[model samples]
Target: MITMSLYSEKDLDIELLEEKIIEPVNKTNESKHIVFIHGFASNSSCWELFVEKNKNHYIHLINLPGHGSKEYKPYHLIFKFIIDLIKKYIISIYQNYGPIILVGHSYGGAISATVTHELKEINENIIEKTILLAPYSKYSILKVIDKIKLFQIKNSDDFMELQKMIFVNAEKTVYELEKYLYKKLSLEFFKKNSKNLKWVILGMSLPSTFYKIDKAFKTIGSSFYFLFGEKDKLIDNQKTIQRSTINNIQPYFSIYEDKGHAFFAEDKDRFFNEIENIINL
Candidate 1:
């Protein structure tokens, strides 16, 4: 059986990719940890607002390889990325502290689910709680956003427009963030992570979600808590709701009626409340 204890080289194989990984460690003790993973095209800084309130726990804000840095090789399939990320951060940190509370936004939330699934796989008490903000829980065929609205993004302006379309009512701060990140977008940004595009496409062609592997939520009731915005066009809450109903999984799924794809960044009070609720649970 795989051990939950981390920082042991014998358990996880991450040495070959050490140089490529970027883990930002901040001030904290060794008892508790909160690992934050950002979504597609975004960096670890996605935890901007939540970080301020939760300064007590140790945090691992990582820049996913190929998203904001050129240090690591690009990942194509989401599963491979999740595996490596767990090996690099989750496992190692579990050794330092114990089980951690994981918070992931957007695609990061999907990645977070995969990590929880992994920790569950080993029956390892490595994840005490999980908060997924607007996560894409399953593998879906490329939707209109991925194929059209997302693929049609030609420049920075187009990217911002896409945000407006998906998030009908975003706050000024979220808009500012969109504009800022858009400015950094370039042709290379799209091509950079294309290596794993093949696997992503394959995932879309087939049934991929949690069924691709033994589901973690199956064993652990309510360990995985989900938060979705009602208007999120990119990741439909309906599918999540449907999936939840069909499977009878998890403890909570808070679908904010007024929010959209950018719910985590746009709504501060609600986002923190959901996370705080999970922490308290």
Candidate 2:
């Protein structure tokens, strides 16, 4: 069974928010600590299969800011809020154990990269290694398009139509989308902090962040790997990887040719094997 715990940052007072720590059934003294961060609108439940497969490794799964059970706070500084959360949780972990390996999915990958970059500046040994799954890299054209899409207000019909386009054919995809929208946008606090939410979207849509990541990768010596699905509808994996070339952050990358954005779910066995290879290395 997965264990639950609560953590806090001074900025947020509500303690109902929880982070789940799933431990391997057979623990070992020499096991490595691996931290997994879920993407936007996703909670730690996304890592349930991974945890089951790699129970031998200490897995720390967290719900990102403004998502999961965490309290909703609207701040214009979205990245700053996320970074603060990372710092607090990571420090707490380090205090109890040692440095950890990070595996992040989608937006979680962006967070992992950003945190690794920040940590490398002060302590090179903060993150033992990092893996990015279907990470977002900023491209000029896409950034421009995203900016245009964000500000362009449409009729309710058009908005609902666009939402449909965002989903995959999978039934689970619709369920996940509904849960995410409800969790993130349903809160009254979210409406009051709309500007911050916009900033979060715009910042994520910028290629500038990826460029910074490229530079940071060159300086940080930690091993990095990337995994993506060939049929990903939301992100162009090739373009994202190509953009990474700008900073020469050559990661060991693999593509699930037959899978979509939710490739891990499509074939957990293959995904688990690939992850085991990376982790054991």
Candidate 3:
């Protein structure tokens, strides 16, 4: 088991990527350990509000390779390699801390589900529960053109335009974050990750990749919470509901009426309450 430490974001190494463990001030045996996984092109810092609100639980925040301050490598762009690294993190965490609940957003959501399902083969109870916030399972082939436009971000205006799609409100917050995102947008690693996403999105248009993506969602053996923002521009909530229903995977689907992709950030209280309710259940 890797020793838990207080390492800053920039201090992370390639071997372990980046991890931040926030142990509850009032730790108890009943205090659950919740591992958080951020979405594509995002790092663990996205869960700042989440960490602040869930002070009763031991929180594990992980930044996917190439995201956050971690050094990016060519292999890190491969989806399988990303999954393998996360799997290792989960296993190590379990070995050191026992069972955990997983909370993942967007791209991280898809990964959380996959990791949870795959790990169940070894120990069905390793992951106590998985709460997926808008898992990016299957992209609509009809929106191929729009999805293509996402990678064409050339400046801050384009990034803000993208942010507009991510949040329904929070104009001020988006504006503030724009400066940071604009800088990240110009970085080589960000460009590479964007290119990787483009290829993945285009590849999903193929029948074979589409089937695999659907199959993954269909095969989740355990019950989980599938939270979706009704107004989310990045994912089709209705299609996600349809697939979940048809598969009978037994996942609970909760749709927030006016929320967008990053609704958690938009309304941290509601998001935290939802998580609390799920964990209690």
Candidate 4:
């Protein structure tokens, strides 16, 4: 069973939403540590399959700020706050176990890239590798535009309805849609940290700001891998892979033909297999 713990640092408090930490029953040691980061509006539960499949390895699952059991407060600092929080956690983990291989899904991918960049700047050897699953580069601009457009609309009901149209998959029922949105938004967190949420949503959406991240990727020396669902509706998977290629980073890329935005959740076997292959290689 996955272990659970609560962690706090001054004003910030987070639930250690971990999964499967026991040593293997067979007594073989796994060399690599894997940390999974879920996408926007989602929590650590998204990585249940990977955790189940890779029970032998040291696996860590985390919920981002303003989500899960973490305290929700407006953090005007945005990415800086996230980076600092990750740095603290990484350091704490390293004290016990060594560096880890980072894996992130969607928005989590973006955070993974950012964390790798920061780690590379501080200590190139700390982050062994990073995997960006269906990451967003240029597409973040679309979200920024959507935010602006959303803020301008008059009625809250209309805005909420439109949000549903944009984010929720068309085939899902209302209950599923609500669950999906609630998981991501953690509406209570939003209510508590409304201003910070606004700044982060708007700030991250900007193309110019995202470009800085691209520049950071260029300088970071860690090996990178890109995996995406071929049918992802939110991002141009091919374009993202191609863009990563231009960096001369030589990332391993995989496109799952039958999957979409939530590929990890939709096709657990394939996702876990890809991860195992990456780690073993």
Error of 2 at 245 (Å): 3.6
Write down the worst ten-residue block by lDDT for model 3.
5-14
Q: Candidate 3 — which residues are off by over 4 angstroms?
A: 1-16, 140-145, 151-154, 170-212, 247-249
Candidate 1 structure quality by residue, lDDT tens digits, 1-281: 87452233443344322222223344534335777877655566657676656644566676555455444432423455445555556777778667888877766776677678776667558888887776655532344335443534457666566566456564465455654453455344655544434444444334445453225334434777778877777776666555544566546778778777767766767787767667766
TM-score of each: 0.73, 0.72, 0.81, 0.73
lDDT score for candidate 2 against the true structure: 0.63
Per-residue accuracy of model 4 over 155-202 as CA lDDT, tens digit each:
445445534433334244223435445333544444444454455565
| Global fold similarity of model 2 (TM-score) | 0.72
Error of 4 at 100 (Å): 0.5
Over all chains combined, what TM-score does candidate 3 have?
A: 0.81
Best by TM-score: 3
Candidate 4 displacement at residue 213 in angstroms: 2.0
> Which should have the higher lDDT, number 1 or number 2?
2
lDDT of 1 at 156: 62
